[model samples]
Target chain A: MFKDIADVRGKLGQQQYIASEEIGTVVYLAHSLCKPILAEGPAGVGKTELAKAWALSTGMPLIRLQCYEGLDESKALYEWEYAKQMLYTQLLRDTLRNVLGDVNSLAEAASRLAQEEDVFFSENFLLPRPLLTALTSDEPVVLLIDEIDRADVEFEAFLLEVLSDFQVSVPELGTIHAKHQPMVLLTSNNTRELSEALKRRCLYLHIDYPSQDAELEIVRLKVPDLKPALAQQAVAVVHQLRNMDLRKMPSISETLDWARALVALNASSIDEKTLTNTLTVLLKYETDVQKARRMMGGGDDGGRHGRYNR
Target chain B: MDNRVVEFIRGLRAAGVRVSLAESVDAMHAVESLGITNKEVFRSSLRATLVKEHDDFAAFEELFPLYFGSGGPPLQSAMDDMSPEEQEMMQMALSALSGRMQQLLDWLSSGEGPSKEELEEMARRAGVEWANSPQEGRWVTRRMLQQMGFAQLEEQMQQLYEKLQEMGMSQEAIEKLMGVVEANREALAEQVAQRVGQQIAEQRANRPEDLHGSDLMHKPLQSLTEEDANQLRKEVQRLVMQMRSRAALRRKRGNKGKFDPKSTIRANLRNGGVPIELKFKKKKLKPSLVLICDVSTSMRAVAEFMLRLTYELQDQVARARSFAFNSDMQEISVTLSGRRAADAVTQVLYDIPPGSYATDLGNSLNTFSKKFMDAVDGRTTVVILGDGRNNHNSPRIDLMKDLQRRAKRLVWFNPEPQRQWGTGDSDMLEYYPVCDSVSVVRNLAQLATAVDRLLTER
Candidate 1:
């Protein structure tokens, strides 16, 4: 849908997703080349958000599959609806009796039954999961496999065949190739190393934490009612906290959450009391909160209150 | 695909980034669709196709500027006017250096190894002072290229350009010469950088031993300098990962011993009891480990190393609890439980200062029995890391006997040499009889072997 890199950037911006030139170029290439993209980074850097924004910009349906440890092919690709098949059997009893009425012998009845066996395993009885749905859709889609690192190695190996061929094989229904190839985006949090074979078949993009200017733009975009000065101070404090040795550093989403919280409290700017009260919004762990508190108490320039003094 | 792109891919592979043939083709297609006029788009296209991991991104960034960014301006482009006499003089000067310059370029482009004498001669001609310091060859080659008549060439070109302008030559002729000179300069610089990079790669491939430090596995821990300790720490991490994978493989193989016929039949009942879905017996659970380490000054390095290894291997065990002591015992499982391995090691070191008191194994064991005995059970394997040095205060043989009775087994890792046991206040002999097994672990290799045995035996 994009004419060039600038077109991609502009469209993503129209959807309220601020993309760097690097992201724009990669998205354009992946679109033109008809390849899957593997996006790896720390958590909450908008890896999943990028796919949603792409789907919105292009006006395509988004099919999402959230990955976990025991995910398997039957869950991801397709499964037979056994209960539906059983109900169909009960409803078709009169029809089956009519079809076999002319047959006299038991073998002749069994042969007649075998002739219509494909009815139970047709498309109506086959339930397509995210992978199969994306492949079989008449219109192109945006398929997002989120947190792929949580999936087992066996599941990853299974994904290799689907991603490369854009087709899935059901034992009953033969191989089904994509009618309109969907744009695939797989996001990982680096929980485990993905297989090299899977990585080789796809484009790779790493989205790190945004720069200070980009982050300030994100804060303003996310929490628009907040004053510019308060947003800047909150971003500056988050930047400082990231530099410190904490168990879990605050991600970009946390920064936005903190900014929104500050705006809700009717605070004009960040100060010691405001920051201390809203610390939980930024940090998840008590140890981190205590550390941030100690850092504030040490009065290294009188903590967040120092911003007001400046 | 352009040959320049192929050469850039070669450079990337040499720098330890794995770029497969399919990826290279993909990169070519990407670059073709998105033309190379825009620098940002071109770079991002290649990066998305060629680089896979986060660590390889740094290597890609370093190689990009050297390969694709070399096609820009040279120094002489800024000076574009010269007089007739100065132009003549510049021509004569270039003729004088032409032969040696051609020879240098030929040697560089030959793709054959040049001797030290030839390299030194080239440096001398370029007016680069070859420093005797042991620095990287790439840096030295870059310095030589900068010093080589590049600055003089710019000055001479400017003088000649002005001299030609004053003598009424056409603007087009002077502009053409300027472009030629600029192209030549860039080509020379690129050739030099490529040669130096190749030479460095060759040297590294020739001597692989220099990459890893000298025999870190067998080096005595007590005598380790800070650098040696850092290297050993990295080695220990690698060793721990290998041990963990091996244990996991064993567990996976052990899980297939016998099939549960009941589960198989019940699971396949939907398919008319043909037993399509066979279920095997679950693997035996891995035993938990409780480590009691001596963190006094004498045993600090080895003890910390052991703790780091055990913590890294925690995934292979059912559960792991760590305790540290100098003169008294402290259960540190809470401190080290959920943190990163490096961070946990740092926290343990900070929490337990290396006390100056003599090694008091007896007192530490007594404290463990009195306070943390509830942590011990028949399923827990107790690993005691110390030299068994008690300073002759008390051997604590009775406490050792008690621990052995309660735990499944007691394994003692003595950092001191075995021959030195029971001599000079060492208490290994007294504690050896009560312990189920005793191993002398003076270095990382020995420690790894002992740990491997412990893991496999379980």
Candidate 2:
């Protein structure tokens, strides 16, 4: 999928995804070794985005499976398409009667029906979910399993087989291995500890919040219309806010959104009045807004205006 | 497998990073595929194969350099570059040294002190640098032994001592020289190890990322920075989620609570009156909780975190009443439940006025019992968070026992260490027996574990 680490880095950069060298190296290795990459990090650090960017860079279709509580094989791997199976049974009722026309005894009829059961349980009735689709696709895909930690432990354990061997076993059809060997990426928010068996099957990568310089670069790329100085100042303010004892620090995406919000307002720089007016764009919790307001020396309109004028 | 890679894997295992046999084999293949020419690629490849969890990344990073660092200073022959005058002076000093010491020095300079190859192997395994020459190699061996600590050295030193005594040294003379030999060995070892460390560091110096995840779990809450606090918050949230699932699983396994005959019969009417699927009565009762927390300065840090836990777990309990107190008690359940967890904690801190800087548990209990006596019932579980310190005042032990009698269970969580429970002004010793359970919660992990136990028990 990638010639080398530099190639991976360059391609990701072209897709507007700034990856660290560690990330590029891991991606390169995962591609060469045909192993899945398990990306763990706090929310909004671009764990899912990395997979999306990889898809865009490689021109491969992206298959995503968003995990949640009680997620199971039927939802993630494959299902039988029960409604389709029912319709098929109804449609095939006449054909079944014709095929069994010569049968007289009940045991003979049952034996004939059993022999024809494979038709109903075959691929025609299989509804391929993300995992199966990724495996059975004609072209390699970028398979993203987002927030996998939210899934139940049993579901995670079930995933271990498919991830390690790139194959899924169906009771009726036996095991079906991958044809294209898709590039798989699993992301976790660390909501729960993932099982060791599942984690050992993949390459581990952790994505943390970007540093100041990196965040500035991201802001410039994401909100190209914003002034350089204004973007720099906004990132600086966000950094300061993160250091504060707030409920939720502004993530990188929030920083970009705040920069865009400032640009839309035609704000030249991060003044206290402007920041106070638009703090909600960055901080979701009211408590954080109040804390930021206090840290900026209160929400007094006159004080903020006087300081900005000077 | 590359010996260095195997050694690196051993180091990783020692640092608590698990590497299974399969993973080690895969890591070897990955290294071969990626090639070791590029340090970044090799490191990432090995890491991707060996490290399974996010937290283990730090251990991998720390161990990588110690194992794969470029060869240390080139090996040199002993006395090859030394001037004749220096060599003569060294020999003269060796002659003046004790016979046992001289023999040991000869063993060292002749490249036979405890086997240089074995010492080098030990150094490589321990991630220490081996000296280049025989003379320096002796110092490296001694340094490595010292680094292994006195207990380990003592065992090896005993064998060496026995060997020296067999070489015809007097008991008194041997005892006299033993202390000097040990002291000199330690000093030379320290100096040589420092120099070797500097040389390796100059070649390539990299420090792993700072402590995170489990490393921060047991640290004191008061010392936690914003980053550490955020990490702890995430961990606590994860624990709460896990506990919720565990409780749900337990409920499912114990689903034979009460037979719902009506529902069962209605459902089985289609199956010719054969009750194929059984249904059980669903319990409608929710657990009630009463949390009494100490908001004094000493307990405030952990108190806030505990309050956060209670807020997150409000759904698990039917009715949760939170009370914060220092010298006086005030119900803050409304504030805690009305807002986001972080906001609620901050708001509660702001809403409650700071009481006197002393913990008056007796007075607080008296206030709670007087005003909220009716709230305690057979279904309610009361949790008290404090150091059990009473400022040397009356503990009102009778009231505690009475409350325990009324409530289903009374659990106490003390942030102070267990050894300090009865010392100072703490009334823990007197009040401990009255409560159903007493847990010492000094950090987030213990706090989470205690809460998990509480949830599961219910």
- In candidate 1, clashing pairs total 11
Q: For candidate 1, give the docking quality class from DockQ.
A: acceptable
Docking level of model 2? acceptable
State the fnat of model 2: 0.54
| i-RMS, each model, one decimal | 3.8, 6.2
How much is the lDDT of residue B353 in candidate 2?
Answer: 50
Summing lDDT over every window of 10 consecutive residues in candidate 2 chain A, give the lowest-scoring window: A301-310
Model 2 vs. true fold: TM: 0.66
Native-contact fraction for each model? 0.71, 0.54
Give per-residue CA lDDT, model 1, range B33-131, as digits (tens). 998999888999999999997877977886676667643332333223545554554455345445545333223222232455665566555433433
Q: What is the lDDT of residue B126 in candidate 1?
A: 42
| Candidate 2: pairs in clash | none
Tens digit of lDDT per residue, candidate 2, span B186-230?
444544454444334322323344666778888987788765776
TM-score of chain B of each: 0.58, 0.52
lDDT of 2 by residue, A1-88 (tens): 6888899999999999999998998898788778889998777888988999999999999999999976889899898766677667
Candidate that would win on TM-score: 1
The lowest-lDDT stretch of 10 consecutive residues in candidate 1 chain B is B104-113
